[model samples]
Target: MGERRGRRGREGSAVGLEKYWASDPMDVLRVRQDFVLADVDTGSAPGFEGKKREAEKSLAVGAGILAGLQEQLFAGHQMGDDPRRILLVLQAMDTAGKGGIVKHVMSAVDPQGVQLATFKKPTEEELAHDFLWRIRKEVPEPGMIGVFDRSHYEDVLIGRVRELAPPEEIERRYDAINEFEAELAASGTTIIKVMLHISMDEQRSRLLKRLERRDKHWKFNPGDIDERMLAPKYREAYQVVFDRTTTPYAPWYVVPADHKWYARLAVQHLLIDALEGMKLDWPLADYDIEEQKARLATG
Candidate 1:
């Protein structure tokens, strides 16, 4: 049955999934309503048993597929079709490897087709508007992939942990986010929300390394230590996030990021899955191909 389906099935079909069951690691890492972050082993790669070298090779191949799919998406939009776009939202505790994901996984695709936005502390001007105002501006254009390093989720994560917003307001933001994401999904955006979960011990070691190296010092922030102290609060807040916002349209994937290589590979597969689901085809040529060929031959 698998072999027969392989010859006729789409990339994301059940048959395809069964064929690649051993390779695709996301099946174990995806966040469902009952997902408990504390129960997840941060040091282990759940479904992937491969080492660093194997993961690297897999990433190279996945990158090529991603690039081709992105091009098709772009071409479809250029042809004035209802092209779909991707929005990858990366949310993680400090040093859980968000930057690494962008550097290793995203670097494999066409930079021109990617719309990356790293949200920082809101400016006074931005503060005046809704929290999503800045986020709305950075959403991927038709046929593009948009990545948010830390997205509107910050309002809930940090706001809840730091008491930045009132308890009632923070509660309201969850419903607001669901509505916002539903709008994006309705408009043909495939939203992939990932939370890179790393161990507190792992984070401490990384921070220590950053402080020890002069070159890495710029990346270090004292505020990170402050945040680290509130790890429990942050975890609670994330649990709330997963409960409230992991909608059918935009589910969260809690990736075990202690192994950077595996995290990168898992993310690559997620992207491949999303693109394959798009089932994009090369745009048809508007001009007459035979006529163009004849004209060229005559010339």
Candidate 2:
């Protein structure tokens, strides 16, 4: 994201939206082919100059815009068979704030039009089928925005990192993923895949805070420490995944997650941009307003 800020809607939101963003997050955060995972400054909010206070107010304004667009997406389905929808795939290591993104950002949209799925370790039933089988069942339907906390890419990431699958098998899954995503794009799902990149040191600090607070104890896991030992391996795996799966149909964006406010705001911009691209509008009333009013008066 060193010089990637697009800033398309910085002055104002999409035509009908009455909000504005300081800058475009996607242009700032979208991963390019030359991106190296190791070089990303997890602590830096690259291309963004806004401070926390400005970000908070901007986030609120963005939520209003998101609500309007999401409502139109719902209306599209309610009144017609509009197939447009959004699928936001989030991937990051533990304590990287995937839940925070959902809680703070997506909360702007109507629950009725949003779908949330968290993919943890596979269950017995999930293991019985292809990795995507369980995933396909959870995809957002018409006019819905679906969020995947951790997704099918786990098969390549942890699977490769832990040697859960043989190298050859792991290699095949990447191609399968690309095809699956292409199909989703063709079917009217706008895909936004993001990797919340946080520094190892930041993660350690957050983990310590969790351990210090009894109320946050449930969020911490000893297994996370085990994973930390394998940071080098995990990073290599992620870089490979970025290389293979990112396509025009399903691109990847990596967000710097050291600043919670910045991460949330960056994601807000990504979602807002995706929704804006669809040009959503309220479905027109099919019945005549005058006729309905006259009939109601006579009755």
Candidate 3:
């Protein structure tokens, strides 16, 4: 919006903005847990100085590039190469805009090239195996972008806060998660982990609005109030998660969620960044292009 700072790439693309931010939003919001939850500005949009309408316009352009890149990646997979895939792991508190992200940022891409997984309570069958058993089953196939609405981190986040598992087992999960993610990375998966940070007051306001409207009541979970009561504990759990699992293979970006537009824009930028880094190219045609053109003309 201001003086563009980055080298231009594809036409009408926001991927170049990665170079403009004084610090990339991904790095600015990364979680090393050097600071506590209170230290983050939930309403602040780092590395962006545009209005909602401008951000939305940029998002549309970015989405087009993302869709094109995704198609190339999918095409490569179809041509038999094990192309890298993106697994966007989204973790956040309730009403922190995860649905908005899936609906807005992700909707920019071809649906056939995307996989969405939402994790709820563990099923009785799911409980019998390792915590990651169900998660492993949903990892995106090559060339498709996978979105984990809430992920294995839940076993540590909610499991620790709610005391669903013993303290020692909870501690063990941190290392287990690190190892599991490393495996994913080694297997051609590029993980972009995000934790949407929203203030307590904002969450309270959103929850209240959900309760106030008859239509929105369907989205309300009474259990959310129980979790809200233990917000401080949950924050502490998240800190431990960042400290233990933010790795070079998979780092966590903490997006401020009080402004839904900023959150959506930031996530789209992150996805674009990941895809751009893949350096995908369209698959080569097995048949001669000139011959095929002549055949089509004759037909």
RMSD of each: 3.6, 4.6, 3.8
lDDT of 3 at 241: 86
* Native-referenced Cα lDDT, model 3: 0.85
Checking candidate 3 for backbone clashes, the offending pairs are none
State each candidate's clash count. Answer: 0, 2, 0
TM-score, cand. 2: 0.92
Per-residue lDDT, model 3, residue 214, is 98
lDDT of 1 by residue, 144-205 (tens): 99999999999999989888889999999999999999999999999999999999999999
Q: How much does candidate 1 score in TM-score?
A: 0.91
The superposed Cα distance between candidate 2 and the true structure at residue 118, in angstroms, equals 0.7
Best candidate (score: TM-score)? 2
TM-score of each: 0.91, 0.92, 0.90
**C-alpha local distance difference test of each model:** 0.85, 0.86, 0.85
For model 2, how does the per-residue alpha-carbon lDDT over 109-228 read when each residue is reduced to its tens digit?
A: 889998999999999999989889999999999989999999999999999999988899999999999999999999999999999989989999999999999999999999999998
lDDT of 3 by residue, 1-299 (tens): 11222344445344544433344576677777475666888999898877687777767766776777778778888875855899999999999999999999889788999999999999999999999999999999998899999999999999998899999999899999999999999999999999998998999999999999999999999999998899899889988888889898998998998999889889988887787777777677777899999999999
Preferred candidate (lDDT higher): 2 or 3: 2
- Ranking of all candidate structures by their TM-score, best first: 2, 1, 3
- In model 2, the runs with Cα more than 4 Å from the true position are 1-23
Scored against the true structure, residue 229 in model 2 reaches a CA lDDT of 86
lDDT of model 1, residue 197: 90
